[model samples]
Target: MTNNKKRQRVPHHPTSTLYSADTSRSESSLKLCRLTSNSSFNDNSTADVILRLYVDSSSPFVWDSTAEDEVQIYLHSDLLHRSKYFAALLSDRWQNPVSNINGINSDNDKKFIRLNFDVSSPTPSSISDHMTVLQLLYTDDFSSVINSVTVALDLLPVALKLLFEDCVKACVKFIEAVPWTEEEEKRVIEIIPLIREEQSRELLSRLYAPDDSCEEMLNGLIMSAIHNHPNTASVKAFVAKLLREFASRESARRVLERAFEESLKVVKESLEEYSSPDFRGDTCETEAIQRLNLHTAMTNGRHLVWLVERMIELRVADSAVKEWIEQAEFTVNLQRTFRDDAWRNIVPGLPSVVMRCTCKLANGVAGGTILATRQVRMKLVKDWLPVLIVCKDNVSPLVPSQKALYLDLEETFLRIISTLPMSDAQELLQQCLSFSTKNLEDCPHLIRAFNTWFRRATQPSLTGDHC
Candidate 1:
């Protein structure tokens, strides 16, 4: 049986309105009162404050008989004073006595406070949120009320507006401890600027990263996927997809190039040690160490092929193409290693693995996936063709798959040679005689290459066509 005839209307403050106007008639029938029976919040006889919550007139919440635009609740000044805003407002009004507070009864001692909100700005949930925070003022166990990110986000701004430090800290702690949805994260970002730097440090740390930290992380992931992970195949595929979808192509390029260079270095050093004249002896220790070196080279050679495919897929293999072309010393060591009979018994797959690395790069160049220059195209074939010839000569009679690998590489090399100058093509094509098979048709790619070379060689010069 609260009396509504004593309530007063108020002038609008920009953030929250506070004013008073006389209203002699009761509007209790039109007003909603959300008065809870909890002793801490609803001791009406002892309560000194009546809070009237309302939406701004311009707000879109349709007010009708069933849904009222405002609600009323009785509160204690001592509990409301826990908020600095209320403490200041109550102290000022008590000392200054401005006509009468919004809903205060002039004939009695009770105070009235009106809080109006634009439902569209903060949110339609704002009224509920403010009421929730005011209820929390009477309780010490904030954890029970502030249980979720949505609850925290809803009440945090209200708490901050009321200058309620404890409730603000509670909301912030809840938000910081939980994971946020992307929409929730955007809300957090929007709220960040409103919070003090010291208070928002942990939240900010989650969103901010140093410039090169991402590149370093990508580099580490690449290495770990290729070298350290026990489940290398699936992990490498996963890492490859990450590189493909990474936002910065340059960063992806730099990370892949670094990994490619490192793998190439290991392969080169392993083969150099294996082919070194010093390790060529048949002694048990030397042969055992040689076997280890060859195995290391073969394993890393597979890694190198994987990296090359990723780089080409990303169109970042230009550097790898150049690096492969410049591997003269490595190729020489490879040829020497293949010429030896020891590796045949120890790692029969080593030659195929090494030549596969060469073939992938050459095919990328030939297919124009990697736009290598004429000199790159020439030296690429010049440097690696001998290794291919040596592998064919020294390895077991090729399995069908291995023979197809060699023939495909031979055709790819000839295609690249066709792009080079006549004399360069002449030297590289002569080496392809080893590519011949008993059935001439089996080697048509080689014949096509030679015929194309001869047609170009015999064509009358465009400059000398006058006669």
Candidate 2:
């Protein structure tokens, strides 16, 4: 589009006088504020609109990211038309500036930022006044203006000292608009907070897609979003939604619990740290934080499934878990694939099923063995068992009642034994019951349980098995 046909810009004008319903023009101005709050941009100006990005000085990756954000906003929102953007950032105590964002398309240092201010096209005289003012602001200030790219780097102190809200806002908005790959996303994730509540929410909304790729990298987004702007409506909704996912899948649920717990620890610590020596003194901010904490806890209760339902209930977000469950269901002729089904089908005289157990190790080497109990879970792919008894140790001596659970479980084995009459199921059970403790090996219960299960659960119609 030619500059000749482009719309005109609004000139700088500020009002010191107060406005009230008693005056017609003042009422109109109040209406504008309401409109702007909802619509973001006005037909006249984006002067009040702010985009902020919080960048870390220590991160080399943030330097370019911060500049890109600023440039995106400058390119999209006209400076002459009254839009502002900046990156708010933090630095180490010894660091000169928290972030350094100076990649301003320098053709031997011409500061291409001026090109954006020029409004791009030659146009009329009277309407050009607004553009002219901006041009002057850009040119005379060649060395004076903080380049959007440079501010995050060499000029963050000056930017903040000058309260350069516009530059900060632009950077954050650019992050919101641009798509970031996983590698790129991590670099910019931290600063979502130092911006404002509104900008942070925009960032998380973008991050919370929960795509398979997103699942792995959600920590930075969730932690920073909740930490900086927990009160934002968007953030509130997001936390609740995450809790739902946690409740759904065991893996996701576990991660969610840990994250929520960490967040709660922080909250509790802050309350303790900032507490006054009164009997729970009343105040708005504290009350708000308290209410938020309560809401999260209450939500967790409603959302977290009990241990029995946790593993058994059918919510499988992980590919591996889904595969295991599918195989488990197939034992009942439900035909769920266990492992690679084609491979397992060829096992001669065997039940064409695969059961694998996983013992998840904690972190490094020494966090091993006994610590692996919570991690050691059994996967009965072909038959996840009508019941899976996860215990402190799978073979802890069965209590009197637990012994009954074993005796009672014989019904399943007997039923199966009755069906597999041609096979040695009956003999297997007799030997299993009388099996020496020395031969129990690593799977005494499993052997005993299989014997009991075969005898108890019977569907007797197998013609070829006898062959």
Candidate 3:
């Protein structure tokens, strides 16, 4: 086809001018400029091919009319043949006889090809992209041109369409080596399918991830934040926020549960060893190892407290509550260790650290952050209450925070106690007498517990009261 041949106009802007200058100036600007610095490209006198590009207003590729809708460029068939798309067009089968019409004689010396920007696909920068790729065919240094991901993305689709191997390779190489913004990553994904499979391999790797990869990564972060990181406070806080904002609550629950179990295991084993050392014959070595065990237990107890807090915050503490309730042996070992004078000098914060785990879990159950069943609630307080009493009795000269923790926990235990059967409450409440102070007003939680119990105990039976 030729530029002068009659064709259907674009529907959206049928009469849109290629250029808006007056007729005299528009005629001169029709030949926009030569596109290449190559000596052969600059000399149109010997050029045998004319390339015409025009946008159809109805075409999806057309965007706002910031540039001219049509353009004509002078070209040499040899350099234009670098693109496989143009090489096919310039071959013998496509050539047609020159014809005369409108009393204008055809320029038999030059071959004419009209390239249309209209296509099934759409892109706002299609015209500029094609123009740039065509300009690149005559140049060797592609790095200077395809410098950024945006520029590479713009030129890549056009290069692939033209089957221009060099430009395609250049675009892909630049993209592979550079980092992308979030938006640029989206663009790279969009263009991946249009390129050859081998060409797209590196880009695919950048975006590819195994199934459940997100959960795996979150699990690692949670473990590192809780166990491996030296800066525990800030990292743990950040990880806690991540768990809260994670899309899958069940996955976060699973990750937190795994971490909680691991930390609990370490704390349990350490306390167990400290309470009943598997003595070697050397007394001094055994004592040193026992001190190390207490320190390990205390350190892991702090980690357990953090993990419990996160589980409660996410409402995924059901399993943790059950597990904590079932640790009757662990609690026993902890009580035995706390009763000794040895741990006071080795790990002064051990009692408070251990009780914080119990306190947070109990508070969660009491406050409804974690919805434990009646049985789980009962066993939780039953197993850990003795540990609390032991710490209160044995760890003296309590810091303000430790005293506050014990007070808060005593109240939480009392609150949980009120939820059980009177028989069960009666059994548990009697253990809470140690919570009372010389001044009864100071132990309101204790006072309220007994008051509520007596109030329920004295109520007339429903079966007999109905008459």
Candidate 4:
């Protein structure tokens, strides 16, 4: 019994071998030892350092209960020295070399140095809560490095407070290496202000910025910025840069057009109601009315015109731009409200914008060829001539500039018709005549052009045999 008790007191285990001053280990051998070891203080051998880890019931790492309120684990001083926290504290404690100090309890029976740590339920609950940090600290199991990112993020502050640089780096590398979900990105952004490391925040920002894979996220971030910080110069610059990029992408253009259409709806509704006799009030009722100056902006035509010009400047495909313009429901809306005395005149340059897009369509190159296809030219003429004719008739009391534009349009129409085969030209002219008669309008210029062309076309001199 006496020999067994003595054996228990002076443990002969791997932990004892690790801290044995008599044992000599090379740096590489020590590294290998650390890499292979799973237990914190291997073998429970003659422990020179005792760590009394007082933990809440939530702790995931198990410890022996010494008393009702105390839990303890025996460790080697050499292993504890690996941590900067313990290294600094032990350095101070060694300078004094006192067995007992006030506020620090000691066990005379154990004959070992003691350090106390308090981990509560609220902070640093367990290895479960900070798996990355604890894994980095205790084991070679780095498999959790990527999968345990939230654990790493949570442990960063704790690691920093503990002065654990290795753990800090592990947390940062975990964050940097992994891709983030949208919610994780939002959480990171929320916590950015709290992080003291400038480099970490920069890494986070680089990660958060939208790439091609996250265009929707980019749009959402921009809208959030506009809503939350409308006057921020950096945000405005970002928006401008993003707008330039989006101008060339059909999907992005469609999104912008949809947003603009909705905004237009809000503004127009408010303006239409603003003129009503029953609408007399100074109080703001709807958000759209309160925030959007629809009457002023729409009346001056600056907002919509700027959007159209941007599309033009970006050289968006002419057909797509024209289709978007049509989808805006602008002509239909304007027709309904234009006759209202309340409407602030017409949206200026509306016709000019359409005409410019038409010209671009008339000049596009075909696939595998440098010249514009004849089919495209015919389609352009067929689509636009009718619209111009209607605009000339319905857009009331045409100004001199608009009338001159109509005349030019007539000239272009005749020139286009002249390029077609006689049979096709005759058919197109007959169709034009049918349209003129059905609409009950005396378009004398159009009728005269069509009649002269038809008469010349049937003269039989054009289709003579060439022997």
Please list the Cα RMSD from the true structure of every candidate, rounded to 1 decimal place: 7.2, 22.3, 6.2, 16.6
Sorted by lDDT (best first), the order is 1, 3, 4, 2
Per-residue CA lDDT of candidate 2, range 1-467, in tens? 33222232222233212111123322322322221232222221323222222223344433222121211111112332332222122222113322224323432322222122121112112112221122222222322222223222222222222345454454455555666667557645655555567757887877666555444545544554445564645764675456455633554545544553454344233333333243144687765654443344333222222211222222322333333333322233212111223212232111111111111111111122212121222221113333222221132444555444443333333333333433444444553343234555834554755655554556565677988
lDDT of 2: 0.33
TM-score of each: 0.85, 0.24, 0.85, 0.38
Q: For residues 1-467, what per-residue lDDT tens digits would candidate 1 score against the true structure?
A: 66442233332221221111211111211122223333345345555566666656555543432223455666666677789988877776655432345543532554444333333333655455666777677666777667778778987998888899889999999999999999999999999998889999999999888899899999999889978999998999899889899999999999889988998999999999987888877799997898899888888888888998898899999999899888889988988888878878777888888778788888888888999888888888988899999999888788988898898899899989899989988988898899998999888998999899989989879876765
Which 10 consecutive positions of candidate 2 have the poorest summed lDDT?
356-365
Which residue ranges in model 3 land beyond 4 Å of their true spot? 1-39, 93-105, 108-121, 280-282, 462-467
Every candidate's lDDT: 0.77, 0.33, 0.76, 0.49
**lDDT (Cα, tens digit) per residue for candidate 3, span 1-467:** 36652233222221222222124322423333334544333244554454555667765555664555565554566777789987776575344423211222234554444344442237655555665676676666676567678888877888898899999999999999999999999999999999989999999988998878888999899888877899988998899889889999999888888888888898888888776747433589898988788888888888888888888888898899899988889989988888888888899998888788888989988999888898998898888889999999998988899999999999999999999999999999999889988997889989889999999999988987777
Query: Candidate 4, residues 1-467: lDDT per residue as tens digits?
Result: 13111111223356432221111221212332244344443344445566544445545544443322333455655555556887877776664434422244445555556666654434433322332243245544433332455655666665665666766666677777787777767756765665567647666667556555455754565455434565655774676577677644765565455544544454445444544445444565642342243444343243334344444444444444344334334443444334433323434444543443343333332221123345544555665655665565566676777666666556555556666667666666654553343443535667666777868866877445763
How high a TM-score does candidate 1 get? 0.85
Backbone clashes in candidate 4 total: 0
Q: Which ten residues in a row have the lowest lDDT in candidate 1?
A: 20-29
What is the C-alpha local distance difference test score of candidate 1?
Answer: 0.77
Residue 409's lDDT within candidate 3 is 97
Evaluated against the true structure, the overall lDDT of model 3 is 0.76
